[model samples]
Target chain A: MKKKNICITLMFSLVLGLCACSQESDSDRPERSETEVRKEEVFGEGEKIKLRGVYLNGDEVQNDIMDNYIKKNWTERFPDVEIEWEGTGDLTNLLKTYSATGDLPDIWYSDAASATAIINAGNQLNLADHITEDHFIDHYVNPEALYYSDGGIYAVSSGIDAFYTPAIYYNKKIFEQYELTEPETYDELIQVCQTLIDDGITPISIVGTTGWSVRNFLFFTILMNDDPKAAQALLSNEIDFSDERVVNALKKIEDMLNMGCFPEGVANIDFSTHMALYAEGKTAMIATMSWGYPELETAQDTGVFMWPSSNPQVKTGQVLQIWGSSLNGWAVNSRSENRDLAVQVAEYCTEQEAFRHAAQGSSLNFKTENPAEVTSELEKERMAIYNNAEQYIKTLHLNAMDSAVAAEFATYTNLLLAGDYTAEQFVKDFNPIWKENTWFEK
Target chain B: MNKFYTKKGKLLFALPGLLLFSVFVIYPMIPQILISFQSHNGAEALGYVGWNNYTNLFQSNVFGKVHRNTYFIVGCSLLIALPVSLLLALLLERASAGVRTVFKFGALFPSVLSVTVIGKMWAGIYDADWGMLNSILRGIGMEQLTRSWLTNADTVVPCIAAAFLWQYIGLNCILFYAGIKAIPEQYYEAAIIDGAGFWRASICITIPLLQDIIKYVVIISTLGSMGMYAHILVMTAGGPGDASRSVLYQMYYKAFSMSQFGEGCAIAVIFIIECIIVSIIINKCIAKEPIQY
Candidate 1:
């Protein structure tokens, strides 16, 4: 009887242990249905391809439009091709790393002028055969903008848009309360700001912490009051920043700050806070880019006008140089296995149809003309600016110079806004870096 | 024959762990040390520049500011957090079992959250216009004091260190609490009988016994405070003119953002050396003989 009881206890314990082992194994196994398995198998059949892209945070070009459209269209168009998209921040560094690793993406998007480093590194694909003159003319409003060294088409340009100046976005409710007319000139704008301040309202909500927004106020004014060619020449090392135009512009911004046009703690205010101040009618005006319209439109009773220039002669003629490029396009990666399929997808996205779709979705696409569905008055004003391309000057940072120089410019601008450096000092700091990194000799 | 077999078995058992430690820790450190001497571009060696990278770093604004900021933050964290944690640990040790468990669990809760989440939450709390702290201050009619906490150079590091204390105090508390709990009941009973009051007993018995654990905690926390990157990155991005930039943060920015791998590696080497020197000095100062109960 004692032996039988011991045997039973041992047998029970063994059975329990086996049950526990089976339970653990079952938990470890990944649960998938037969249909899910089949779907994954079908999806896996295509020749796998990945494309790496670098994009800006506020652009909404890649994530909102291109990625979504490609994912939808690629599988239908090419059943055997699988395209994977890897997006990266900080385009300048990303491209440099890629060049270092020799792991350039199969297809990538980069600014044409700023791509000199990659081109110098011998990593860029020569798309001369892929792009033709007729294609260029049809796609780009100004084909000359796409020109690069070696007289070969390394990349294609997209449709051109007019440059955007730093615009004054005012709260309409505040303006109506003060019975203020839209200021047309720099002096008038200053007077109106003073009036608003006298009426117990903060004159301008400057998000100086953003650095770029503060820079826009400084850069646009300088470009407007100064000779364009001279300013460009100075930036390109043809002249010096110590010139009167640059100095006067810097002085004007400092003068404006001293005049109580900006808030007490303007330098500490971030973009969101500035916008909130405008929305709540605490401030009369805020300076920002054309791209900011989409976000600022969410504010109550918002209105925008071009920033007034100090030079009376050129005030009307001067517009904020569209600080970046219009040549946003897709490229097929040289290392891609499904190069043909990737090119097809790229072409499809850049075509007129995709532009129309993008326009309908409240995004500005390069190829498409004005879409009728863009009912917002602000967008209508933006579309007019886009149509009148000759009225604006294109400041080429994204497409005109090396990206490292632009990043340095951004840093200097930040220092200037932080009151750590003067305009002359800013220029002096960048001159050597530009000489070292760029093709410019001096 | 049995002794020889046991010795062989022990060696065989220890081999795998030793191999892993060498591969993961000892071997990788060799490359890190070597990379410090050569110039690089994020990955590959650009060229050899012995001490040039380090020399340039000394001349740069980022290095001096980061060094000062790291030491300041570590100092603040140690000065404020260590005593608070010890006090909490002592108080909990004197409580009932149920109360002790509750307080211990409460203290450990902050450690459960990731650093990124804590940073973001504090950012909201410290926001100039819409932050909870500012709102409370305004309600109390201290609106003049409402300023951008993270952007102001004078306040940013201390603000970040305060957040660090909140996140880490609980951990230290739990550790010291465990150490205190591990002390035998007889020691405390003898002290009480010898007319030792609570404070006297703690200073004489509890603190001395917990010295090793305290030393370890201080060293680790100091290193952690020096190497703080993610909180600053996610919250302020070492912004408002590099007010909160740490050495590690600067190294990461150079390597990942600017693609100056040579400078970054150089910064890393210097940072490691600083940490080592600091740890050694602390160990020497705080080293104590183990007490026999």
Candidate 2:
């Protein structure tokens, strides 16, 4: 009995040792074959060039209008080219992860800052050689809009220009009832706000919790009161954030909060509720971008005006501009066998006719010629803004900084919105780090 | 002589388990200790940074806040959850056999649901715009008292702890109930015959009998609270400026989001040591001789 038990225990130990060894070998064996499979699967379409494109879906032109229309129309136009569209969550992070894995799609859309990072990481193809001087005029593209870094064109600017305006999008009925005209200046706007408040309306339904929306107010104040070049100078370290102009901008926001211009519990209200309050006519005006027009169209009788600024020199309709990169353009993967077909398909999609169609759906792109018909009134209004675009000054935060610096900016903004750090403290905390770590030396 | 050898052989049969414990648990711990000495980016090992990571952790404002919040939450959960579960278990153990089974099964219902689902349900209940709690508060003419419970730093931790308590109370109750039922009824009968009242019998017979189960519960509960992750991640997301960020959440953020793998490993190593120390202290404080009866 004793010998039998000892023998059983020894057998069990030997079996366990063999199992663990086999498991280790099995795990290690997959990688060699897996790489071969991945390479063949990703690049195996020899004649049929299937270009995968990832885009965001929403009411915005990129999603609701541009992507949907492209999916429907592009297939009919290009019978030979197979375009596979995949909508992804968190486009920036997805692209970054793809770049890290070296399994990037043929084409992807990203902001200028992210584009810079992708280029720095050596994943993006240089398109300057492909794009001729005549192509800009022929395609009705604005040559100046293409982003240039270190004196070389890296990405094409999307024709759609988000001409950001910190405008008072007021209900026409409410404005008329309160006897309010388009406020001529910042002080006059304050007076209009007071009048609306006295009439039992929440003056401005500013969404403080949505950091981006709250930031628009700050951007507007800075652009209007300070020099237009102030942002660029600060980013380049020519001017400090502690400068008088920046401080004044923050103080103005504080003053606005203290004056009860915004609704009570504005800090807690999210973007949806803020819009809902405005849409329901509980609020007199909402300070938002031109992108807000589609949502406001459903609300009763709305009109837009340029926000009045403290500086008279800063022109009316002049607001902060967040430009989209043409770098979001398509590129054929070097490893792909169907490279020629992919390039041909990319050219066809970006052709004048398709560009015009895409422009109609989105407000960002500038069209070479006016479309035969404008589908939405908001589109028509946006087109008018683009036609008269020389009147407005453009600005962007992340686009102006290095990729890493821009990420830091986003982090700091999140921190500021959380109320853990004040705006002034945020600038002080970041400026030194920005000066030290930036790729751009003074 | 042959029978003695057989009994010794039977004792040696536990060797496989011991070997597994060494390989899986003990072997991996060696690498963790080594990783604590290195600096790591997301992709590659970035050489030793001495004690920089630890020093940085000590200096961080958010880390200090998260540590305090975690202890407070754990303390509050234990104070309310443990006593209530014990009482419920004791009551159910004394009931009829059928009633005892039904109660035991019913108590396990919440534990059947995933932590994510429980978190979502609680978030909805506490939502500022349309939460049931705020709606009820408003209906009772206490509208001013209604606030965004999850967003506020003062109430967010307690609100989350209450959710944790609700989810785990059933499981703990079942554990205590099983422990109580396992005890022989002869001691209780003898106590009753000796003119011992219900309270006195409970203190002398029932409580002492549950000493082992009580020790196990305390150790498990302490470890569970220390390593709590899923509920906080799904519900609060360490939000409102890291008000309810626990050590596990911070460790995860370091490993995945920030991509500081070495520091994350270091955190895990320290966390294990802290848990062990805590367990030892608790054992010492509550040490008692086992009652064979």
lDDT of each: 0.65, 0.63
Query: Distance from true position, residue A442, model 1, in Å?
Result: 11
lDDT of 2 by residue, A290-345 (tens): 66776887885887665665777765445444444445544434333344344444
Q: In each prediction, how many residue pairs overlap at the backbone (N, C-alpha, C within less than 3 A)?
A: 2, 10
Q: Write the per-residue lDDT of candidate 1 for residues B48-129, one digit (tens) a residue.
A: 8888887989998768999898888898778988899999999988889999878878888888888888987888788765
**TM-score of chain A as modeled in candidate 1:** 0.75
- Give the CA lDDT, 0 to 100, for residue B175 in model 1: 91
Instruction: Indicate the worst ten consecutive residues by lDDT in candidate 2 chain B.
Output: B37-46
What TM-score against the true fold does each predicted structure earn? Answer: 0.80, 0.71
- In model 1, how large is the Cα lDDT of residue B41? 51
Least lDDT summed over 10 consecutive residues: which range in candidate 1 chain A? A30-39
> Candidate 2 residues B65-180, lDDT tens each?
77777677668656888888888887877799899778777789888999988987887788775689899999999999998787677887888888888887888888888888
lDDT of 2 at B11: 59
- Judged by DockQ cut-offs, is candidate 2 incorrect, acceptable, medium or high? incorrect
